[model samples]
Target: MTQTDRTDTAERPDPPESSESVATGGAAQAQSQFRRAWTRFRRNKLALASFVVLVALIILAVIAPLIAPYGFEEPDYEHTLAGPGTAGHLLGTDLLGRDLLSRLIYSLRTSFLVGFGAELAALIVAVVIGLIAGYRGGRAEQFLMAITDVMFAFPTYLFAVLMVAVLGRSVGAVILAIAIASWVNMARLTRAQTMTLMQRDFVEAARAMGAPGVTIAVRYVLPNAVGPLLVAVSFGIPAAITAEAGLALLGLGVQPPTPSLGGMIQDGISYVTSYPNMLVWPAVMLAVVLLAFTWLGDGIRDAFDTTGTRR
Candidate 1:
């Protein structure tokens, strides 16, 4: 070979990496991001405690049927309104003689159902609308955002009340109502994230390569935007749970014998002076759920933050 040819060959860079290597690298990067976020989350004592508590509560709710001393509706008419530690009723019995502890366990299951179900529904609607509005960016964006703005004007609780009233009171109705009322925040956050991601070089490259809008959105934009979206969802869940509780308090949530936290609170209100434990137990459980979710959400948001600011 010519001396000049040998020199040019040495100057050339290594060939582009194979597709398998690229995929593996992407996976590793994602794993690293997860580890960093987890590390940050673990460092926050309140958040770590909340995670453990939340997981334990979920487990308790799941196995409630096995552990509960009595059926939620099964009454011990002999011990009606009995205080805590009465015979088989550890936490006492309601006016109907139903075990308070058993009802509380079932109520927790109901709350979790509403929280996760509503959040899942809200995520679907929010992500779809946000992606279309931000990625398309035209009259479509203007129209969709206009609707979102109108939704924002209504008070969330009032809107949820109206929906539940219209749909009729039930678990399914409560889930749908809370989802409709709560999706606006997620949609707005998602839109902002998608808009920012669209300006990225990778997105531009995908577009230049003739990728369809859907392909670019799913393959490039959505994955990049997921971190912020998850943070939004973590925050959104507690709101959904609270909304359900409020609706139940107002007699528009899960119906009688269903044993929702709010319903228990409503029932307990009548006996507040006579037997405060009835009111206190459900209220305490609700407070724990709310605080756990709020603190955990704060931790997740902080962990995902790239700004390196500790709260």
Candidate 2:
């Protein structure tokens, strides 16, 4: 206990924090980030309302069979062309004597399937191509980007129409056609995000540690890029829905016996001067779906933007 010894002991730094504490701190930080994003999203009143409506619409589509008053194609000979609030036919019957409400409900299901299915297919293609192009760069990047550029050169909707025509009109074909047309945007986005993230300190450290490229891309790069990716997906869903509807309108969508919003609109157009409800209901639903996704996408983009603040 000499004076020099006492001074040396007092000047020594505290021990490094435990691994458990570091893990806890990381978890806390992630939670805080999520909370902040959610708070920002909630501040957007229109977006919040749209999200609720979107969720309700999804639920309705899921349970359409249970809630719809009658089979989508069931003909009510006695109630042909019945108007709204007609006996047993809530929204009335179509030209074929089928219930409008049931067809609309089933049509919703078809639209959602196309939207989510197409987007998911596009996402898979985009992430794989984008990640490889960005992470590997050099010749790989050049080859992949060239293809993406070619896709970008085409008008997306027209390209989709051509693909649908070639592939024939079916739900699966429509989804594939839309995916082929739509994936270029997301691929470019993912590539940019991956390249930017690859330059980050953590990613560089992982590279220095001799981690495999796939491991680094999946473990570090992908997670960091998820926010922007989610925003992109939110926007893409509506685009997919719109494409499906347009195809259906043009008679190149899912074939007969499978109802779709666009098909309903097409059917209603001939009867527009007669029973307008046939045209109005499906059009209104389509408009609502488009608006809801657009608002939600904007909200998500704003929320994830660290530089922006929503008042």
Candidate 3:
């Protein structure tokens, strides 16, 4: 109504208080989302079973020395290649007289470490590249897609084998090889999700406000895209682990004295007629690990899917 009234209205603290309320609401929403996701995940019996199995394997791997009566690399000359139920060897003895049980436990640790590490590396690279490429579109998207196509054309196993051959047999080489081969899927998944998210109302609002490209992509796009990305990651770990084992079985993964499940299984091929425990334990371990990841991924997919059943 007057100059003083105009000044008073302009100086009112309502806007700041409103902004604070909005920020608080956003934080509450994020926490609620995480809680709902966890609740959904826990309700799935198969997923919970997988989580329990994963936790058990982790515990076994962590306490390998205590749980395993003998060292992974220790050789019992008198008990070499003993079948299951041998005097001291629980799972039996390998061709080298080493304890199969110990090796199996240690192999679990190595498999998980390599798988998780490789997947994480691939995931980081894929998410970053895919988000940027998809968000920017045009030439960047085309170029990235072209490169992804090229990668997809080559068989992953062949690429990994070649990389391992060049890099020599070692844990690091195996991890790098698998990561290189595996990242394409992650990249594609992230790109597709990012493209979809780019059209959402929040993103449009951010664009209207003249927010930076990076800010919009990171703040809005990535959060929405993480659901599928997590599913991809869950499956990726087992894939990497199996890949590593396969490579090692072919003598391109990890070298001897390293005690890898693949290496043990490969060696067991020679003693299958004499002692079956060597092959049995490794195969069982691999199966368990794969199953755990498979169930976990299914659980995660269900957790995020509105149409998915709770169990």
Per-candidate TM-score against the hidden true structure: 0.91, 0.90, 0.87
Candidate 3 segments exceeding 4 Å error: 1-31, 308-311
TM-score of candidate 1 on Cα atoms, chains taken together: 0.91
List all candidate RMSDs to the true structure.
2.5, 2.9, 4.7
lDDT of 1 at 187: 93
Candidate 3 residue lDDT tens string, 1-311? 99999999998876433433443443355456667889989989999999998999988888887887787888999988887778777777887788888888888878887898899999998998899788999999999899999998999999999999998877888888889988998999999999987776667766666778988787767877777888899999999999988997787878778887788788877767777677878888899889989999999988877664544
lDDT of each: 0.88, 0.89, 0.83
> Which has the higher TM-score value, candidate number 1 or candidate number 3?
1
- Candidate 1 stretches greater than 4 Å from native: 1-31
Worst ten-residue run, lDDT, model 1?
Answer: 19-28
Relative to the true structure, candidate 1 has a C-alpha RMSD (angstroms) of 2.5
Q: What 10-residue stretch in candidate 2 is worst by lDDT? A: 19-28
Residues 26-88 of candidate 1: C-alpha lDDT, one tens digit per residue: 435546777888888899999889989999999999999999988999999999999989987
Candidate 2 residue lDDT tens string, 1-311: 99999999999999975544543443355466668889999999999999999999999999999999888889989989999989788899998789999999999999999999999999999999999999999999999999999999999999999999999888999999999999999999999999997776666666656778888788777777778888999999999998888888788988977899989998899889989999999999999999999999999988888985644
Q: Residue 44: error of model 1 in Å?
A: 2.1
Error of 2 at 234 (Å): 0.8
- Candidate 2 runs further than 4 Å off: 1-32, 309-311
Error of 3 at 18 (Å): 9.0
Error of 2 at 282 (Å): 0.3
